[model samples]
Target: MDERRESPGQADGAGRHREGEALPAPPRPPRGEELGGGGFAAEGQYFLKYDHSSYQQFRSWAPAVLFWAAVLCSIRFPAAAAAERSGEESAPPRVRVVIAPTLSYGPLWIALEEGFFRDEGLDVELLTMRRTAEALPSLAAGEVEVLGSHILPSHMNVIARGGRVRIVADKGHHDPDGCTSEAIVAAPSVIASGRLDDPARFEGLRVATDKGMSGYFYIDTLLATLGVSAEVLRTFDLPLSSKEAGFTNGAIDFSTAAEPWLTRLVRSGTAVKWKAVEDFVPGFQSGVILYGPALLDEDQGTGTRFLAGYLRGIRRYNEGKTDRNVEIIAEATELDPELVREACWISMRDDGEIDVESLVGYQRWALREGLIDRAVAPEEFWDPSFVRGANEILRSREAR
Candidate 1:
């Protein structure tokens, strides 16, 4: 592997990332605070390394000695921080994860609050970004470690070219037979006009998309099946929080929404649901877990542990909208507990798999529409090794 990595993109005239130009390296922390010394960058995935001596003979027996020690001691001392305080152990790996504020971030939020990440021996810091696209640059430059966001068309330019970021796991996606996870809604006037069934009527229509177009995949895909090209419609990028206002205030005639926003708006009668993303493209991946350089290139052990923790969270989340899950999601997202419970819950894979076929199909559509600069092969952007390792770890732990 080349020691030097490439910057993914620079802003074009239209403010879109254009590949082949460089983004400046992210600002570095002061001495002693840099990432390298934290041990997370090169820590063992399954075990802590407390042995430092160069005795060649010990190499044969040390791994066994240490493995049992870890097994025995781990029960008594759950934190790697305890070992670090003895002055003989390396610091525990610390991960800074960026998550968008929504129900889609259920796994990460659950993991953070439930101590799953800590159980995996990781010190994790959670950061929330309202518009996940704004965090891509920092993520590509490794200023941030992991991200919980949707798989956007624009981000393909970065992942396909630079290799600094990766789609490691599924955050959330539309379940075709399940209650709506994402939908396209039309204003009452548009619905009343009955032009919605006429493909030609979509021309010059106004639409509101989630800011950064993360959730636009649902709208764009749903509309395309009706023979409406995205170029024919005028689109506005509004925050998820602002979609209701945009609909009621007539800022947009059609818009895309995710639950519980979908439920909230529908109950409020701001707009009527026109289509669900899954209705058009079944099992379409909407939300994803991204790995920046820290996890993608520098420390896969931590990445594996991170995914393992996240999978544990997924299992907990898959337990349905139990009172515990409802409370955690409500507190984390600040949605009303009643609304959270009333809303159609989102679904994700228990094993952290991304829907590659759906992803590739979306990429082809994006390329055909001139919506993205490049398309990536599944292997180029999605790495399955971490998920495989994570599952193995979970199985081993369960056996014990």
Candidate 2:
């Protein structure tokens, strides 16, 4: 049989240490240490030195015990380690979007209907206000998080007033020879006299729009291109809701308008098409995405999430034949499907990219006409980061 050796904590022939290795001595007591029992004798016997009346001795081990206990606890438990490793939470909050009832917002409806925001873990509520100007004030007041109804001049006016609104994305750009949803509507009398071809026709005509808005800018620019000073035409400031009636009642000889109103005017004999915006300013980006300084301060994640979700919807809507998407847009806009289909096929850039060049042109003309204080830098106005992020999401989904 093999012989076993004793270890430091055991008696000879019973301890766990190897037989050839020397055992370490037990730790020595401090000077003047009291002995609870007499030291071990040569025969391995122990005896108490103190009488029964005396107090029992204690070891000075509180600090050492606590140190070792902490080490042991850390080794056995893991939640503390995990707590140190994880950083702050990054979950995004809900994004409230303000939109208009214009045809340019078709993409947003498509995105909502297709559940793209849901897929991206975002909660988006879209509220359609009556006009972009109203939405701008609400956005400035923090009542809304995003605005998609902001056209160039309205945004510029806000900036001029020292508001910190910035364009973060594009809606749709105009296409050449496109069936423009925008029309410079004229009275039947103006159309009958061949004023549509006469550069001098608008010299004395009063035109109405939300003053200092892009609608006004577009019409003014068209007149300027015809060598007619904007000062020559009587410019009227009218609420968008009043535009159709204003045109029909002869309150204004002409006015600029977007869809449904244009459709209404055409159908109801209130307005005649004097000019198509696309014919004069092809590739002009109509609607834009905007956010005020408060929104930019509160969260960037919300913006990213909204864009990602929105882009996903765009891709889904454009998935196959555009006709299906057009039908969907028509329903959302409350226009005849055929009219919506015709407008969709013509008005929007086929590729869904906003025309930056056209915007640059619009700005130049606005400066020349003195609509804005000065020519705002293109970089100062538009923010494409959200658009880029949205496009990336689309590309990634396509890959999958």
Candidate 3:
């Protein structure tokens, strides 16, 4: 028999250390020291002295006592360990997400419909808050846990003030080779009269825009590249639903449109896609994922799990706009199925990577445009580690 292997019964006086090595005797107390019946320490080891009768009783019963204790421990602890491993010990967390009514939220819908978030042990609730100004304060207050919305100067202002909301992942960006995801369209007359061809003729044109929003950032950036100052154009702060009407009545000569709205304007002959955003600002980081205080808590992994689920959804979205993708988008946005199918979908980074430099550049522009009091470093507003953790989680799942 191997000296290290002990019989489970231990009825033959086999109590020993786990390594099966005999313990060296502890150093003796000083000569004639009056050791009492109480436990005492000798050198670094503890000793429990017993009288002759106590020693006999202890020796006979110790083995059976330890044997039964081990059996009970084996039975009790594995059940608790297994419960923890299966995540049944704790209740699932509910994560509330805010999004706009647009195709950009397609990935979020995909994640929800596919049970990706649920797979991460999260229960997700989505709320729609289209306006950036309204959404920023709500996120800062932790009323919502996640936000998929525009990169706004107002949001930067909150971060500058020490807000805990974080920009975690990329939601949408202008793709150089993809369809018209974002572009500045013009009234048919504006394009027909050759105004679109002459950059200088952009002056004094009525533009449908909300100068308070980051739509100004994209417009200003593109106009700057063209040597046309945005100041020369008249601007209108109109809701997205009202922009089509503005174009229909010739109330707006220029405006920026995204996705199905872009396709709708062109289909109605209300506007012509005169300039693709990539021609001026390639890979513009127009949309981002934000996390509120609940998700940003350092001690919890909720943020990482939420993003991991979202990245899974993004991978599914990147598989091209198939019938399923169109169906999800049409139902989510309440757009016609044919229109959702016909519209050019915006491109997203499959790995949930955000263009940090583009975000930095946006803040500088915001500063110059007086939209924010100061420019913020990428670290102040962005948290890339969630994406890193999310990728690690996905990689581990794949490896498994």
Best model number under lDDT: 3
Q: What's every prediction's RMSD, in angstroms?
A: 15.3, 28.7, 23.7
Q: Can you write out model 1's per-residue Cα lDDT over 69-119, one digit (the tens) per residue?
A: 455455435445565677666545767776655777777777777878878
**Candidates' lDDT values, in order?**
0.71, 0.60, 0.73
Q: Per-residue CA lDDT of candidate 2, range 39-148, in tens? A: 21111111123444222332353344455445545543464456456864433255666665566676676776566666666555555444445567667766667778
| lDDT at residue 283 of model 1 (Cα atoms) | 86
- Which lDDT value does model 3 have at 390? 97
Lowest-scoring 10 consecutive residues by lDDT in candidate 2?
1-10
**TM-score of every candidate relative to the true structure:** 0.76, 0.67, 0.76
Q: Which scores greater on lDDT, model 1 or model 2?
A: 1
Residue 276's lDDT within candidate 3 is 86
Worst 10 residues of 1 by lDDT: 1-10
Per candidate, the number of residue pairs that clash is: 0, 4, 0
The regions of model 3 sitting more than 4 angstroms off are: 1-90
